[model samples]
Target: MNIQGHAALVTGGGSGLGEATARELARLGAKVAVLDLNLENAQRVAADIGGVAVQCNVSDPDSMQAAIQQAAAAHGPARILMQIAGIGTAKRVVGKDGNAAPLDDFARVININLIGTYNAARLFAAACAKLEPMEDGERGVMVFTASVAAYDGQVGQQAYSASKAGVVGMTLPMARDLAQHGIRVCTIAPGLFMTPLMRTLPEPVQQSLAASIPFPSRLGKPEEFAQLATHIVTNTHLNGETIRLDGALRMAPR
Candidate 1:
């Protein structure tokens, strides 16, 4: 579907992949809404792109509804929904000391990453379902964010891995479920990307992580992620698949 003049909503748009996507969509002439937990960052990006910024908590239904309503009020119902809001907490299910991991930590990750994606996607689909179809009965598109850990989880990543794995697990079913509604669903499992979270680590650690990749030997850029997202939105045939953005890297068990 053509993105020009369409309403698009991007979660976690304050920074990283979501920020890059919002910029790209705006460049393509889409009316974009930047949603993030950090209102200041969201507002900054929104201002730069001439879009609306919504302070949103993807995990909370009411919060997401408010954010979506705010976006819709400004740009109309979002025909494109990009879910990038997620959190990672590193903790071993069984630590070296043999203590069991806290259940609340796992629940928190699941709530933010897995449930949050689902919550926003459902609302996006609901809103888009009401709109008239474009060509070939296509109404909308949804792109979700998953991590490489979902498939090859390392140590100290039980909660994070499980959360991402749920995202990966939902791709085909979601696509199938929404197919009747002329909505498409897909996922991107990014490898080591140089996101804001990654920037927090020491330079040496970052370099080590970069070197671990088989080729290109560097982290993926946020723009690269945005590029794929744009392609997914414009390309009509792509759906129900989880594409790995990793640079030929299969994460080793740490």
Candidate 2:
């Protein structure tokens, strides 16, 4: 489907991959809506791209509905929904404290990453289903963000891994279920990327992680991820798949 003049909604569009995708979509003439928990940063990106900014919590149904309404009001119902808002907290299931990690911590990650994706995808699809189908009977596309952790999580990442795994697990089923509506679903399981969060780590640690990749050893640029997103949006045949954006890296257990 052509991105030009279509409405695109990107959660976590304040920074990192979502921000990059939003910028790219706008560059391609899509009407972009930048949604993030950080309204200030979302506003900055939205202003930069001449798009709409909405403060959203993907985990809450009401919050997501409000955000979707705000974006649709500005740019019409989104035909491209990018789910990227997620959080990861490193805590061993059995920490040095000799206790299992708090269940609330686990729930928080799942709520934000897994359930949040579902909330946004469902609402976006509902809106798209009402629209007239585009050429090739296409109505919309959804690109979800997963993690390499979902498949090969090291220690101290039980909750994070489980949440991401749920995302990976849902890709095909979601795609199949939405096929009848002319909506496509796919997931990107990114490895270590030089996101703002990763940049905060010590240089040595960052370098070590980069070195772990087999070849072209470096962190992935957010633009590279955005490039893939653009391709997925345009490539009509691509659906129900999880593509790994890693540089030949298979993480070892810590």
Candidate 3:
């Protein structure tokens, strides 16, 4: 699918990977909608990219419905959807808190990461399906973000791992389902990247995490992730697969 003049929606567009992707898409002639939980930050990124900003709670169906409608209003319909709105979990499923880690929290991670991805994908596909097919009979494509933890989650990542795993599980099925409509789906499992999620760590701690990588031995730049995402959007052959963005380093259990 050509990104030029396409309507693109990027969840978690406020910072990190999503923001970088949005910027890249905008630079490539796509009109982007920056959707995030943080209204101010979303607005800032949208302003910077000359796109619309939408405040969306991806975990909530109602919120996503309204936001998707708004995106349609602002930029026609989003034929390119990037699912990056997700939360990180550090608590165990059963913790030392006597009671097990709250089930709601665990469910929430699934809701935001997995269900949220579904919400955006469904909405984007529905809108795209209404449009005429492109040169290759491609209606649209969606790119989702997962984590390496889905495969090798450390001790405290039970909830996070489970949720991201669900994302991985869905990629192939989703692509098959959307095939008739000429839509495609793919997932990206990123390794240690310098995203806003990890920015909370101390600078030294951040360095340590980067140093742990094997070959490149450094954290991934957000722009690097964006570059891959851009390639996926532009390439019609890539679909129904999960690509790892980690730099040849497997994670050690924490």
Candidate 4:
């Protein structure tokens, strides 16, 4: 469906891939709502893209419902919902200190990464479903972010990998359920991208991660992920698939 003049909502729009997607959608003339837990960064991106800023905790049903309502009031119901808000925590189930990771810590990762994505997707898609389908017989599309670790998890990534894997596992069935309404569902399992989380590492660490990539021997760019998202939005045939944007780099055991 043509997204021009349509409303779009991107969670985690404050930084990294989410921010890039929001900017790209706005560039395409879509009114974007930058929903994020970080209000400061959300407002920054929102103002920069001439979009709305919504402070949201995606795991909370109330937060997501209220955010969608406010965004719709301002820009109309979101026809495109990008579930990019996530947290990556690295901790072994059994640490070197011989202490097991707290259950709360593990649950926190699941709450933000997996459950959060579902929360926002449900809210956004429900709203879109109520609206009329587009000229191309499409009501909306949802793009979720997962990590390559979801498939091949490295050491110290039990929680993070499991959460992301959940996101991947849900894509097909979710798409099937939403298909009757002409809404598409898909996932992007990104490899060592140059997102804010990666940038936080030391330069030497960044280089080590870059060198780990098979071909280009570099980190992926946010815009590259944005490219995939844009194509998924416009191409109606592409659905119920998870595209890996890792430049041929299958993650190794850390």
Candidate 5:
């Protein structure tokens, strides 16, 4: 389970937590592949990290398969997978105008956040299962991203929360299924973090959000998340668990 000198794949590596993870893995001596929907951003991170950039749509079968193949072609088959690519939306089941929320919104979020996660994991696990086992019969490890909203969703977050909750739900079962292949699966349900999307909010709004955390009363850092993710890879005994990276912050209903 040592990360050094192994091949790793990070989806959504263009920005935010995924970018931080890609850099950290590279720094730790893993040959990293940065996979993202934005080729430009992926390339930027890949170049800086001396890794390969792949344009990937995790929800698309062909795109995800091609991306895995391309990364293997460059870095060899990856034993580490970081499933971070996802989208979010906030919509009430019934809008202010008295119309039911568009079904497309809910479907889109589920497709990207939930189904997309499974798509990437299945392809990665299939390939990793073929690799020779490392120490302790471990061939690979994968970390999935979820959110605190999955546990306590605010108003108008039906789609976003459901999608993330699905990820949280999948963790233990997926781990159990892959255990036979010497592959481990875990999830991280992060609280508020200073991601690109969060940065778009007004400063005052951001400050208010930060103050909501019970202690340390500030948004979580991307590097912190990355650190935990890398730790999960090295700690062989940890598997089938969902670690919450929230700073003791149970979100209030909005």
Candidate 6:
């Protein structure tokens, strides 16, 4: 479907890949809504893009529902949903003192990354299904964010890896389930990128991580991710797939 004149919802639009995506969508002439837990950040992006800003908690049913409603009120119902809001953690399953990893930590990651994705997709699908189908009977498209850690999680990444893996695992099934509703689902599992969190690391550490990628020898750009995401919407045949945007980089187990 053409992005021009369509309404789009971007979670985590406050910063990083989500922010880049929101800007790209707006640039493509889509009516964009920047949704994030941080209202100030969302507002900043929204103002710059001339889009709406919605404070949202992806894992909370009421919060997500309310956000969607608010966004729709501003920009009409959205046909594109970018599920990108998530958190990362590095916690060993067994600490140096030999205690088990806290269940809360694992739960928090799963709730936000995995369950939150489902929440956003389900809500978006429900609303999109009711919309008049566009070309090829397509009502909407959804792009989910995952990570290379899902496939090759290093040490101290059990919670983060598991949550992302769940997203990867859900891609095909969710796409199939939404097929009848005329909604497409796909995932992007990215490798090391220069996100805010990654930038906090020392320069040498960042360079070391970038060197791991075989070619280009640099971190993936947020705009690269945004480009692929928008392409998925335009390319109708691509569905139920998890495309790795990692520039031929398979992570090593640490």
| 159: Cα error in model 1, Å | 1.0
Candidate models: Cα lDDT each = 0.95, 0.95, 0.90, 0.92, 0.95, 0.95
lDDT tens digits, residue span 90-137, model 3: 886666866678878888888899888888788778878888999789
User: TM-score of predicted model 3?
Assistant: 0.96
Model 2 global lDDT (CA atoms, 0 to 1): 0.95
For model 2, residues 1-254, the per-residue Cα lDDT tens digits are 99999999999999999999999999999999999999999999999999999999999999999999999999888899999999998898788989988999999999999999999999999999999999989999999999999999999899899999999999999999999999999999999999999999999999999999987799989999999998999999999999999998999998
TM-score of 2: 0.99
Candidate 2, residue 243: how far the Cα is off, in Å: 0.2
lDDT of 6 at 104: 96
Poorly placed runs, candidate 5 (over 4 Å): none
Task: Please give the lDDT score at residue 5 for candidate 6.
Answer: 96
Model 6 alpha-carbon drift over 4 Å, by segment? none
lDDT of 1 at 184: 96
lDDT of 4 at 67: 93
RMSD of 6: 0.7
Show the colliding residue pairs in model 6. Answer: none
TM-score, model 1 to reference: 0.98
Error of 2 at 182 (Å): 0.1
Tens digits of per-residue lDDT, candidate 4, 187-221, equal 99999889887888999999999998987899999
Candidate 6 residue-wise lDDT at 206: 92
Clashes in predicted model 5: 0
Candidate No. with top lDDT: 5
Report the candidate with higher TM-score, 4 versus 5.
5
